[model samples]
Target: MAIFHTSIKTFSRGKGQSAVAAAAYRGGLLLSDFVTGQQHDYRRRSGVVESFCLAPPDAPRWALDPRELWAVAEAAERRKDSTVAREFEVSLPHELSEEQRAHLAFVIADALVGRYGFAVQASIHAPGTPDGLNHHVHILATTRRIGSEGFGEKTRELDVGPSGKVQVQWIREMVAAATNAHLEAAGLTDTIDHRSLAEQARSAIERGDDLAAAALSREPTQHLGKHAAALAGKGVATDKASTNDQIAEENREHYDFLVRKAGLEGKPAPVPGHEPVKRGGRVFNAETAGLPGGLELRGVSGVRLQNLLLSSHGHTPEQAPISLAEKILDALRDVEEISRARADLAMEKIRDALRWAQRQLSSQGETSELRQWVTNAALQVRALKSLIISRARRLLNVKSATRLRHMAEQEWERFNADCPPGSTRYSRSEWTLRRGRRLSVLEKHTAELKAAQERASEGELNAIDADILAKAELLAGLPHPSVSALRIAEPKPVPPDDLGSTRSVPRGPTFH
Candidate 1:
């Protein structure tokens, strides 16, 4: 299981620096600070001090401006020793839909408020152009505790003291758990605990590694020595040097030292290659006699076989009956597994092909051929369902067998009319089973196609072309089109009751 790490840090901010005030100013909302004894009457706009001009008139009256909140949090980080509020941003792997992102923000907000008793500042922002993703949310939370610790007495608020190092850890753990639970419930299993690395810093905090000392002791940077700006600017020049001069000098000095230590300066120079050396076959000399496939091996493994052929049958593995039988059996089992896997893959491919065809026929308004194709596809799907039921029953898995049987029966019921049906002016025969069996099937197919067309019109997919059914899936998915206007008849106004009796009936060309 993947784990999410947590951390916390705190700092004694500079004199007169108020995180709450900054947040309020950035959000363009009036805020009351109990510490400073200030309150704003929003109804009369009487205490509109330092309002954010950029804020829209109808914006929510939340005091914590998301931008200011983020800024304050980021600034709170301790760069060297002092406190600086800062924020950590994480990029999710999957692009969530707008609805999903909204849900995430709400869940996080609720969790924070439930635990801390203070509402967190939450906001969603759109990425700049070039990013097609539709989801990005930022959560800013107050560091101070609004009420008593609920989780435990040793809660982050009470344990961390003033610096907040302790709080970061608990915050990370709780947030990660909440996020993981939410995503898991929604079937979004592919996610990352981005805070895990930063949480390691909490241990440093416990060890009394103050912010200043921690800042001085820089992490061992990996990948490259230069910073991003330097790297992007240009390459650096290097001094030229001989490749082996230093190594040769060291070797000569070592040789002299060894000669002196041995007390034999005139000793005959050690033969350069006289030392006995172990070759490839030394390890296997006589230790493996009766072991399987180990006695006087001849060419057997692929590499050995190739080497023997290269050397004209010089090396081979000695094989016994048991070893050969084991190898053969292993190969057979692998082949069988591969065959089964291939069959499953083929079935999946066929299913995908049929679905694609259905979509294509659905896009092309209504046509006799399209209707027939749809009917055939539906029957094929039903047949596959029947096969599934039969297999389940044979396997003796009653639960699965019953489930498949139920599904098969339901599908059969849907195939009401014999095999065909009739057509009508207002609604096609497809809408009713009273039509002939043949017409009924045709009508069903026609109805499905019409539905598909409607979906396409609502910006679901491109007009499904015949080519889509036959061609390899285009890797580039389709984009939804802009919403189009639908024509609606406007109702005319009726004459007022008070004016009804005042109108005189005029006769054409008759003098009154």
Candidate 2:
């Protein structure tokens, strides 16, 4: 395997306003000594140092004098138990670009927030060398750390104590995450893991070769497997650390039990909670699962509901590779676009079908004239519900262009479906029997999806907007005659005999 290299610099703020200075100093030191895949040290070339520090920039007004900052940084490094602080430069593989380097920094910073509940200040340094290969260095740090009382500046510098151990672990995680994210984004799966350098070193030591172990520890192992193989050539044996073994030792429970408990094995979704009430001959209930507290958190509208669901439950499920929220949001965005497109497609189909019907009738020598066929009123109501859902998805996804299209399609469908039959004048068209029943059902679904999408945005989490949109749209189209009639007149009742009892008898004059 070829080597893949990354440079991660860890810094600590001493006392006072020297935080940025300390950060820059550590950055320069790391840049100087980074392993650039070459045999000779790149820092030895005086030109490298001169060119690095002199790169174009109007230095910050708040920046401390370079001389004073360097003195402060050097003093901190000298305070460490490990006395030597040298900056070694390494040329990274040509595949990495400056943008990629910056992205890498962001990924590390973001992951740190997720794992450690802290955010970091980051910077990327572009490699300046003749190989035409790009090498970028990253600095992972915090502007300040939060304490119970208030925020405080970082006072401790980097060293090999408990804090050092913590920093090392942090570095390992950052490197691993950044590397994986960068490679994945770049569409490269077969790369190296730089985080396991320490583990590999420990393994090599256990194999009875002190020299090989020392070499592996000191030399940057860009590719863990390759590094191990090279060590093996010198009769140094090493084994990949077994995370499963570590977990088993930590927990006495059977592995299977642990897996299930951790939700490694598939777990069924819990049934959502709702209080059902019979209204207009249909079951109705207020959705409680995604709402703030089942009390309906105020100001959260339907437009944002899908995003809310994504925030609460999307990432927790193991079935999704990304966060469930992310998947849902992606799904929602896709579904909204799909639903809108679907409505348009549905229109096209309707137009084609209607046109064919008109032509066929004309060919049959009938003169009734199709006269602008419209969607059934019931279907129109369903379309409105679909439009609302699609619009909600669009808003949640931050895509607003499709909302109008969705609305128009819905209105068109409704106008075609619900207009009264045999109305000769346009004025009477407004009074046609509407499918109040089906519209009501669709309205409910549209409202729910909109609410979910809104919650997702508030939580700043991933949302399955598309999936919810599609499902809600489908529900809106369901036929419901009883509710449909609500808009036009009183709901029709069952015959008294069909009700299993005769409540009243009809009185009429006898023909005899």
Which candidate leads the pack in lDDT?
2
User: All candidates' TM-scores?
Assistant: 0.26, 0.29
lDDT of 2 by residue, 1-512 (tens): 21345443443333222333433443433222121121222222211111112100122211123333233233334333322121212223335433344444444444443333322333344322212233444333332333332224442433447885665554454354345335544655434444354665575578654433443443221233436544543434455324333443443333334335436435421111111111233321112121111111111122222233333333331222333223223323333333443553233332333344434444653222222121242233244445554444445333211232233345446645645455553355343433343344346435544554564464433334454355444444533323333334555564767668966756798997
Off by over 4 Å in 1: 1-94, 128-137, 147-167, 194-512
Candidate 1, which ten residues in sequence have the lowest lDDT sum?
478-487
Give each model's clash number: 45, 55
lDDT of 2 at 406: 38
lDDT (tens digit, per residue) of candidate 1 on 1-512: 22232223222356445544544533334555454465432333211111111111122223235434334343434433433222222222233433344444444444444444442554443321111222334443454323322111112452335736544544454455444444544565443443322343453366554332233223322222224323322323322112233544554555455446435645333211111122345333111111111111111111221222223323444432333223323333322322332343123433444444445445754344434443434333333333332332233223222332333333345444332334232246444533344344345434544443444442332323222222212211211111000111234445545756544545689688
Task: For each candidate in the order shown, give its overall lDDT on alpha carbons.
Answer: 0.35, 0.36
**Candidate 2 TM-score versus the reference:** 0.29
Worst 10 residues of 2 by lDDT: 47-56
